[model samples]
Target: MLVAVVLAVAATVGVVLFTRVATRPEPAARPTAPPPATAKVVRTDLVDRVEVDGTPGYGAATPLSGRKQGTLTWLPEPGKVVDRGQPLYAVDAVAVPLLIGSTPLYREIRADVPAGPDVRVLQENLVALGYAEAGPPDGKFDAGTGRALRKWQKAAGLPQSGVLAQGDALVLPAAVRVDRVTAQLGAAAEGELMEVTGTERLVTAELEKSRRDYAPAGAAVEVRLPDRRTAAGTVRSVATASAEEGETKLVVTVAFADPAAAPESGQVVVVLTGARRDQVLAVPVRALVALAEGGYAVEVLRDGGRSLVPVEPGMFASGLVEVTGPGLVEGAEVVVAS
Candidate 1:
């Protein structure tokens, strides 16, 4: 009986051990996540910029009124570029030419008139037009001046009077492109006659007075055209305009580096670079990883492995962040969240 009991106890112990082994749950599979995406550490230049709206066209237009007192017999076609010594319009069948000067022809320019700045301007223009052979303009209407005036008059199909009348020629600062003909052909030539603008195409933009430093004169900028092309440009001028709604504004004019590349008319983007970094280690901004230690770090990938390296971030521009750190070479790769 004792031997049978011992054998029974042994068999029960074996059965219990087997049941415990079978009932034990398999080791839970540890949760895992795929590796993060990555990008490269590129060496590139960065330019911090401010973009603003700009309008492209021939600069501002100024009214070209008729200074001659006569019946308007002829007018230049719109879009005609009137240069110095060229006939701007005809007055009663007499051509009134264009002259480059600041002073208008308010009185007769002849030998008998008092010497003045207007005479000097006329003499200078005469010399420029190759109609006069004289020294620098002395402001005196001498015999040479009379000869030059007569020569110009003859060339313009007018009688050689040797005297410049009160309404002889029109004076403007420079050559102008006729924008619009405001006067009719048969109307009296007295008031507003036409509108003219500079021949060069320029981009005009309005900037808030507080942000004037963003686009100072002579600063370089990039112009993004309506067709998605870019062109180099320079800030030609900046002027303060009258305050509107109690906020002052600035008028900024930009000229194309190559005028041929400028479009005739369209709204453009003016990119003003405020700062630049050259030949620096850069990466996509997304590659920047915030650290729990109060600084930034980048997960650098090397030799099929990745390690987080602390980096000092610099200027951020064009979706790139300038980074600097130990062992951060140009060709190295960095982790970026997908």
Candidate 2:
């Protein structure tokens, strides 16, 4: 009977202990909160600018061919600036002067040649060179034209043939700078003679076809040179066709108002301005919070506490948004979601 009493007491103790352990109230559930990411509201100027890769060089190099079929006795050195009425190269020891015109002197321009646009080009050039007081009557090869030709030939130290030959002069649209000379002393001038470019320095950039309007003609821009210096530029031309053989990027040429402002060759950065906001309160665009009703608000942390302050957003630029509100001020901390 004593052993039975002891066993029964032990059994009752085990049951009470089990019930107490199971009935113990779980530790009161504690609320958990994570620290919010934050950023400071800043007051500054914001500019919406687009930067594109560019190359600084003399616009485009165009190949210059000689119409004269003879020995190349003279060629200009590379980088030489040749102007109107100047000798581009010598053919058969005869200097072929440069002329400003659109039409080439195809046929022999003599007093008997029929009146044509070529004659008009020759006559106008003679007038501009001061060889003649005025152009030929009705652009016809007349007695006045012969007198001007003889004067020009004499001034150039050439024989007074009184007749303009087919290879006597080279006509181009404007003044050019020699980029390269393919003809050597005594080489044949029947083919390519040299390559030339415009005298102005230009920055060429390949802009995507979709953003074609970003660089329209006459748009003002800033060019950051390879040396980190910046200069002012304007869009000179935007190619209507593709700039590459197998691409669709439009070629944009930006010209420096002063050609001397840019280097001859280097990589460049073209900054195009879109919009700007001056001295406005702004924050990282990610700092904005959407409201349940409508509009946007920012979770501002102040006095060791946080609250949502409604904000009116304005111009957005460079990953920042302009904000305006009664409570929004510079140096205020706002939450930005990572």
Candidate 3:
């Protein structure tokens, strides 16, 4: 009986040992995927751009009125480029030339005229035309002014009366391209005479008021032309007045650096580039992982092990996002989810 009992105890022990061996788990397999494809952190330049639809055409249309009323004998054709000394239109067979000045000719300009801004305008033009041989530009129209006026009149085939009528010349701030002529050859030169715009082509866009901060005067921009060509442009003007609709909107005008490269009139894309950073640390946007708490983080691979690193995300361009964090350096491997 003792022998039998000892044999039974040995059998029970053997069965327990066999069950433990069968239930034991195997060693974990080594990962073969290399911790999900990884990308290297790089230091490069980044530019954030906001693209908006824009119209490519003349900058702004300015109305040109006839200074004097008379029969329109001649008018510049639409699309004609009028320079400083060129005739913008003719009244009663008399050509009214264009002069560059901000001050309009409110009254007749002639010798013995009192010193005023208008007098200065005439004097400046006279000096520029080599007609004023007496002295520098001055507001007073003296005897030298008379000689210059008569010389200019003679050259322009006008009566050498040394007197400038209020409508004798069309004054503009700068040279312009004739956009439209309102009056016909035989029509009366009265009221609105024509329309003009800057010589260079520009792109105009209406930006939402909320996004007004995105575009400011002098901001650099990129224009994509109809031919798929890209051109550099600058924000020339931003209208303070907002158009009232469901949402307020502001007008933004961008002038192309190379006007000749711009299409005459068509729809284009205007990309407003924001602040740029050079030699900044950046990584693939996919590598970024949102932390459960609040900010963002990235999985950094170091010494065959991955560590969750907190990062401050910044401007994003292309597929890369700017990031800054502790121990984040160029050429650092970052794990990205497949």
Candidate 4:
């Protein structure tokens, strides 16, 4: 009976404890709030002026024999640095058969001779090839003109022909040469015969017309040569029309402002494009949270608080993108702590 009384008392105590534990109230869960606006980051970009590849070309053109493409003569014997007015070719005076009638300039051919613009073009091209001797190519073959022609012919080993043959060559424009046969030995040439060139810039590059706008004038540009040498030059000229290749091109001509040596012609090179930003709004791309509702939003922090605002994105250059949307006014102290 005593043991039974003790066991009963223990059982009553256990029951009282269990009831007390079960009656205690449970701790409440902490509430969760929406993420603050300032927590999110929006990327931004700005419109910028950029540069494209362009090449320095002869501001002028030099004419060559149009007779088909004769057996590629001497190809400007490699390594000859002929100077301005330097003789490049000397054709034998033998009466080469002319498919096209040969008429001396004295009669000057009764055909509609180019008077003003056409002559201007000739003079300009002649000056470019070092044949016109730097003065305004007056289109009149005066003594100075004869002197230049004779100088070139003499150098070319042609007879001291004071007479400027209608198809005689003036200079070799390009530095490369290839073997090509274009006319019948006894046939004739109805086009330009002699070719010539102008001064050499440290490097040369060609630009496609599509990228013309990007290659602004006075752009800081550089050219990498095969020897790993980089020559610097400014944009001297930009061709306004599409080249004969049928591709619109902006020939950005650059000459080494301070070149150790003139860049060799006919070398392949890689051109680089660069960009800069002036004054514009930029935003983080990731900070742009697309709320399922509509429009885009960015987080902003003020006095330890956050706010959300929508924005309209604009042109992007490099890493930054331009934006002008809700909460994005010019000079509106936006934070880009990152």
Tell me each candidate's TM-score: 0.71, 0.70, 0.76, 0.49
Q: Between candidates 2 and 3, which one is better according to TM-score?
A: 3
lDDT of 3 at 299: 94
Candidate 2 Cα RMSD (Å): 6.9
Candidate 1 lDDT tens digits, 10-124: 9999999999999999999988978778788999999888888999877667898887888999999999999998988888999888889888888888879999888988998
Note the clash tally of each candidate: 0, 0, 0, 38
The RMSD (Cα, Å) of candidate 1 is: 5.7
Ranking by TM-score: 3, 1, 2, 4
Candidate No. with top TM-score: 3
Model 1 accuracy (lDDT, Cα): 0.88
TM-score of 4: 0.49
How far residue 176's Cα lies from its native spot in candidate 3, in Å, is 1.4
Model 2's TM-score against the true structure: 0.70
Candidate 1's C-alpha runs over 4 A off are 1-31, 39-44, 51-56, 134-136, 185-188, 205-211, 224-230, 239-252, 264-270, 279-283, 287-314, 323-337
**Model 3: colliding residue pairs:** none
Instruction: State the displacement of the C-alpha of residue 186, model 1, in Å, after optimal TM-score superposition.
Output: 4.9
Tally clashing residue pairs in candidate 4: 38
